[model samples]
Target: MKNKGSRRRPNKAAAPRKGEAASDGAGGDRLSKLPDDILLNILERVDTLDALRTCILSKRMLKLPTMLSRFDIDVGNLARHHDAASYGYTLNHVIQYNNAVAGVAEKILSARNLEIPIRKLRLRFYVGRDGCLSISKAFACTMATQRVDNAEFVLLTEKSCLKCTHDNLLYYAQQFNNCLGDYPAAFAGLTHLWLRNMRFGELDIPNVLSTCKRLVSLRLSNCDAGVRSVLHIEHAQLVELCIEEGKFEAVQLNGLPKLQHVNFVGWCCPDPLTFRSVPQLRKLRLEQIGISSTKNLQLSQFLANVPWISDLHLDFRSEKIWVLPESPKLLAPVLGKLQIVNLDNLPEGCDMAWTMFILEAAPSLRELCITVWDDWCKIVTDKEFRRKNGYCEKANVEWQPSDFDLKHKNLVKLTIHGFQPDVIFVRYVRRILEVAVNMGDISLHDRKVCERCMDLDPEIKVCPSRYPRTTEEKDMLKVEITKELGMASHAVIHFRS
Candidate 1:
């Protein structure tokens, strides 16, 4: 039966609801007509709690919905329909929410009777006074007997929740004391794990990573693990590690034989990170990271320690690094093994020294990617999210090709997205064209208007290939670039909007 005031969904058949026998003559819906995997895909999109509610009272719902593998629920949407900011709200609604959580746990426990494994499960919900103690127990019972490869449990604190009340937040903070030890013991087979906004006791880090013997990737975001002291992380099987949105005084990364990638974002280490015995690391990505080097450590020293790095992405666009001025010679360290380099971020606007540093350090580099957004992200706070969707503007710089490598003969492909014609950007473009001898058609694209920014700034111009859009700004810049870049008559320059 359809509920009142609900918008009409597509006329698709659904799986049989609880208490209905598969052999019953009344259940000939199209949902039961499809294969089990397709039905599970459709169910994965709905709130996981809805499935639990429908099967709550049925004695035959012991094995859960057939072939249902992935489940996700967003607790933040609990009162999205109506403004819960009302003072008239009472304890009855809170109790009902708690009961709903307990009910879902009971339903998940029914997965014990299944033969197939749950591949992925994600829960982005609030952790009120009781936290996820009940749900974790349910997972311990069911997941211990089955396989769940990927899991993300984000416990939203009151500060992160806009609609939650102070009273409710107090309850959640007091109850969210569960640690990695509270998890299922079957985690030995898990490959990927992400925990956000959770407290980590002194030993939780090692215990969690070691428990998942096969865990290949791990992420910790906005986590509390006594960051004031040095935190050491070591694992034999871990290949990728990420720490973001938090500040740590110091970190020691050691003894990971197979580790390949390390990503750090919005992280500040007062003492430079100490890398112990990671010999197999091949890739490193640092974004908006702040490092106060007391030991006068050159960034190149860090690169030299990882001799096999093939790809490097250093995004310094978000946070400011002030010590860059004191160390203009930081880039000429040792990057001879690097093949690809992404230096698209502009620290304190653009600088010619950084570009010269990477080019001189990495002589074997083949490809370069740069962008110039229209400075819109800086002007409009409402559209700030556009920056994350690949909308960026190149910083204007006065680059002197003579002071550095005059001929970058190795670069074969050059892509310049969002070609803005400011004096600084024009200078940077002309400099690159002059140096890259083996370069092909220089791909010049205009600014991109994101889905949200499109209505406000309709030009929406950006091309991967060397072709100009029909916008007047792009057409005019195309001709100007042809004249200014000074490319030979035989050289082809693709102008794109």
Candidate 2:
């Protein structure tokens, strides 16, 4: 943004004229030396209008922008440009902002005459005033003229912005809906899609998937449908799916054949994560997830159907901790292929036992990383936060792992975080090293403290708090685990802050 005292220069970019010469015309020029395809690919990375602006440079580059496989129509941040941000939202400022939106839509419509298919398209526009519905219909008309493989359409309403009121945003969406007809007819070519903010208002997710059978990957993040609609997903060509920060009542995932990756983050409500016959699912991540159903939302059930999941990461925040119990059906596949596992937010005094239970099940595990939050440590030092979150900071109980001698043969590397020097914790580590004959390397790290945690509650103490784990405490645990486990003299062990 430029101040009035330092006015920005006017646009020097002109429309493409015939027989224009390059600014510097040697064959050794950096841009001209590249092949025609490479030059076109570089232009595709920019916005369509910005790409056209380059046509003023040379005549040979004029025809290359029309071959762009990707198109982006962004208007959210355009209001912050020099012309629009010089003053407050007065009458003149609002006119300039609306003109910027029309300019972006016009550039996208120009691609219709090129005839080449758009492999990927992303359009982000604001919906606030009278022209929003017309803009939406013009966008659909442009879609009807061209074929697209991957497309994302985001209509940012007033609910998502602070400058406009909710009534104005809802009116714009309602107006757009009254005129939007047969939009599903254009989904025949869309395979990959991502929608934000606009949910069932303009598009029903279930109906869209049912109509578009060729969809491979779908992501719905921060959408109203997650809270308002019931999503019924069943596709044969779908491979990857992600639903982040949604509150859906019933999200049914059924009969996805080629599905390999699934990421569901921040399930605010207690909804069941249904899994119906996904055999090829491999990689899975559930972060900041909590379910209301204690029985149906079990990890064992999700793993029983999918046998080939190799890499797994789970970060849970819930009323109860999930125990890794022995299951013949799940253990058979996990023992054969499961290689890497990362577990975070593991509660102290109760999670060590679960670690052994997991090791017994996955005999082929190559790497294991666990993040433990010392419950007693936090209470004794940082009591206010624990109390604020309804956690019992003062409740006293003794806990230890169940007896097991199962050989975790393939485990060669291990990293344990939030290491404490208590007697019970040291014994748990000693027993694992004794049974795990192929132990190669182990690293124990102190707890990690972030700025947010320290800023939120000043009463809580940071690492090396009132009761810090001294060097003597760390040394005692290392020495005992190594000596009792009968580990080789050359095996490596490290302790770090």
Candidate 3:
């Protein structure tokens, strides 16, 4: 054996050394050979802190920030170590983190060819007693010159301006002044802006708007200050706008020739006299808001005047109707061209009347939902009044099934709620279900027919003598019993009657 192979137990160390060399030939060597541009692209995809860590690898990676087209600085990450109760004292960690970001940003700013003009910038900071102003001032200064094509500013805090002093306003003004003072003329080409949980007064709104002449979209959420004041948006290039839960008077579109979508919340109501100015407006949503309750103020009337809007959503939750006679007739012709209508939380009395009116008016109305109370007396009384005047009698009218055609042939879904599942209701459900079974092409249907009739009469349960059933009848001896009741269902599948 020694003569053939010279293997006196071939050295194990040599084999292990060969395997180590093979492993080194793959990943480690390949990664090291990748071009700097490719490595910078990889680092750019990670968060800022992770991006910074790439610098630790080698001096060649230090210039990675110049390749970043986007920058998102989250200040909340800095303040995580401070307990709320101990927040009155200065947090050293917050200061350190701020300093670190400032240094990185400075590097980004100073890079000549490496500082690619940012296409987007997002800053999230909590406005608070300790460190918000300085951070905002710093961020604003950077933004004022960054030539960002899009920017988002989010300031969150539980502190209310209503509780703060004049000094607080002065401090805010100083920060705002810093941000707005030399706002680079470069931002005039920016296209989008989003602000959340940040308050701005009348002066601030105009000042910010002036910076973005080419802005196509703007969104504000949960910000308050001069909320009741109307806005005059004068951008010719704007197309979409959304404002929610902020106090603002009326919204006036100044000169947005390309504008199409508008969404609003809080207390702004469109002025009926000035709505048609935006000729291209097509879609609008109004939610969780108040409209004038004066007898002369009518939503339908106001909406009718605007011919450009094709889609509308109105939510009047817990709101009292200001206009009297709650006629669907007034709303129908106006909404004839509408593709969708959502009426939520209308009062029981108003709901019934509105339903009838809508069914009559909008022959083109596509969907309807109505919720009524569980009171039997109210239903009976209302039905009696409607029937005496030649409205469909409660018993004669066929309940609309999910497939049933409505005044509008296109209606697809109808949901009703808050009805007492009593004897009368069960019979109503039975009638509706019977009608539904006869309809063709059933799809996505839910018919919750009552399983039992409950006696909702309060006085009937108090005395045994007042019980309607006799002992013999209860035992099948047959005693006579009687009660009268009343009516309605969805807007779908056409019925011959």
Report the Cα lDDT for candidate 1.
0.57
TM-scores for candidates 1 onward, in order = 0.68, 0.67, 0.55
Question: What's the lDDT of the predicted structure labeled candidate 3?
Answer: 0.49
Model 1: per-residue Cα lDDT over 227-311, one tens digit each: 4645688888889988875446777897888888888765556434567788887777766522223232256556546666778
The TM-score of predicted model 1 comes to: 0.68
Clashing pairs in 3: 227-247, 227-248, 228-249, 403-493, 404-492, 404-493, 405-492, 405-493, 405-494, 423-453
RMSD of each: 10.1, 10.0, 13.0
* Comparing 1 and 3 on TM-score, the stronger one: 1
Ranking by TM-score: 1, 2, 3
Best-fitting candidate, scored by TM-score: 1
Which scores greater on lDDT, model 1 or model 2? 2
Total clashes for model 3: 10
Native-structure RMSD, model 2: 10.0
Ranking, lDDT, top scorer first: 2, 1, 3
Q: TM-score for candidate 2, please give it.
A: 0.67
Error of 1 at 305 (Å): 1.2
Q: After superposition, how far is residue 445 of candidate 3 from its true place, in Å?
A: 12
lDDT of 2 by residue, 398-495 (tens): 33334455677888877878777666556666766766778787777776565445444565543452213676765655676667444472255667
| Candidate 1 lDDT score at position 425 | 57
